[model samples]
Target: MSRPILFFVIFITLLSCDKKENSVTDVQVLFEKVDSIQINYLGSPTVHDLDPLSQRVVFMEHSLSDSGHEIFIADFDGNILSSFIKDGDTRDTYGHIMAPLAIDGENSFMAYSFNGFIHYDFDGNLISRVKIVDFFNPGGRILGMGYGMEKWEGKYFYVNRGSKNADYGDKDFFDEYHTMYLLDPSTGIRESIIPFPENSLFMKGNFFFSRAWEPVFHISESKLYIVFGLEPVIYIYENQAPFNLISSIPIELPDYHYFKGSEKYNNEDVRFFGHRVTSGKISNIKYVDNYFVLSYFPGFDAADTEMSISTNTGPDFWNAMRKKYTTRIAILDSQGKVLNDFVPEGLSETSMKVKNGELWMMGKPNGEVELDYFQLFKVGLTTKGP
Candidate 1:
């Protein structure tokens, strides 16, 4: 084949998986529940960050205070080491929204917020805080919820919201919106690199629905992996400067179903609620070891009472709707082939992380369990003949 033709063939393979056969026969995934750690805490807590070197995990609980958050540090044994509510000076308290925590290094972690990075030790002591604007100005539009950020190859990488004047009606809007950026705090230089994929479903037609989801992504070694909530595609990019797209992996999840929203209703309109609630979304993504770990909510399909939008609009509407969908975890290889996909009992969709080369997930609370206690476990993957 000519060089141009070979390049075109490879590009086509990256774009879609319709021509490929099922890869499950070649790879089998077996998960072994290693051990469970029961943590004792007051309110409901979600895993914010895990530090294997320090043997500590950070949990965030909703606070009634003006700052709206509290932090707890617990060891691998589930013993609460320290807990604190934001207080003292402006440097100590974060913004109203709770920023996701990233493990900085040994015995310390950092929170990336709209203002900048706040450093804290595992003992609940504040180290220092740096505002990005003071060092690197990200135009006038950097004050938004950052999805996730990490220091890779001496550069800070994070995803920020796109333009405020985004024209949703335009078919090309999603492709042009830059959502990822690289910042060198030391050099005071920043560059917006990745945008939504040009071949994304949102870029396909008049799909004007913007779920306002913060894209979940991770940088592992020399590669970057990103997966949007509204789509099932995992995009791979080079982890260096310019960050060009390497390939696109479209996943065909089992039992996944969705309903595309109508363009007439804006993102916030009530009329779009049915489509938004019924749609299947990629809830979480993480790259661990050589595999990609993903948790997703397979869209609910059931009786009228379960799916009805009108009857479900009570105070507990959101909670009730959540019970209808089952959350499943899938282990995918570096090539985006599903090795194993199954729903594990007693695991929360929001609290899974890679710890010491294994997947650790926080336990989902059953109504019978005491609210103060949290469960943690290590998932071991074994390969067998399909």
Candidate 2:
């Protein structure tokens, strides 16, 4: 074949290959329920999530106070490899570790605070800071909730909301929905917005929707999945500028459609209730090759309090609430079809992560205290014969 014709043929073939859909992946997935394997580490604030590297795993370690936080890098044997962001006071290099964004475990990682974000390597070496005060929002536009962002393929996707106490131009002080933007990593400018369905707001209130609601984003390959920490919905999109919402999955959480007003709480300042109707929501999600593994809590019924001596959910509220409810998990295929559903006892999705072909999470044997152990669940996939 001539050079021009050969190149043409190769181009055509590549285009067709890109058209191949995931439905053709004959890979069948199964949860083996292999007895839980516990990491040698234990205690309150145990390893929350696992970021599996070829040689180690990295998790964000937070102390009782902000100053002692560090990016804890450890081995499966529970030996510390290296810890990053040694001192939170190093404001020039590292900011307060408000929320752990993610770490590639090799080149770069991100940590978030109320101010903005700081980037570092696995060794805690500073790469740069994405400071909003002097860098991005130099205008000091109102102080809204800062962003939680992730860097994928050299681009950044910032997720957060506007302020609830201060307004900036068109944005309301009590905005109900979370806002996402495709940000320029070099300039820290919002290039474009990623729109969510207006109906997806858990509620239209102020702090209830803004403060209590947590959202998580998982990126696998070239796809991004948006999961509400307090709702059983998954929004999937192509991971790119102006992320195209390709599909959505509703996992049917308890009272997901139920809503109420805050007047019942005797707080007129609070807005209406939607997510408050249900005490639980989807806690975490992991996107494996051809499967979507997610975990959720069914929530505790207040009526259970009437059945027990628990007159008040005081200092032991978390323990009592955990004992009061159960955790559920679901497995879905690339087609958004349910493959299998199971609720494992003592499984928490609060910091669940899919790593090295396993579902990793924080769990307790029989917790009277706080989450005390990190465990792994085996996820099995078998390719059927054609």
Point to the candidate with the largest lDDT.
Answer: 1
Which tens-of-lDDT digit does each residue in 124-200 have in candidate 2?
A: 77777665433332211211111234556666664554444433222332243345555554554555355445545
Question: Ten consecutive residues with minimal summed lDDT in candidate 1?
Answer: 7-16
List the candidates' TM-scores in order: 0.77, 0.63
Tens digit of per-residue lDDT, candidate 1, span 1-386: 00122211101111113332253445666555666667777676667767667777777775465655677888877778887765435657755322457677778877655545667788777887766554332222221112335678767777655545656667556666677768654444557777767776665555645553446677777888888765788988899877888998988776666555455646665446555666677767878767777877767554522545675467576677566566677778877888767666666654666645557766678877568677676656667665
| RMSD in Å for all candidates | 10.1, 12.2
Off by over 4 Å in 1: 1-27, 66-68, 87-91, 134-148, 162-172, 183-190, 212-214, 260-265, 268-273, 301-324
lDDT for model 1, please: 0.63
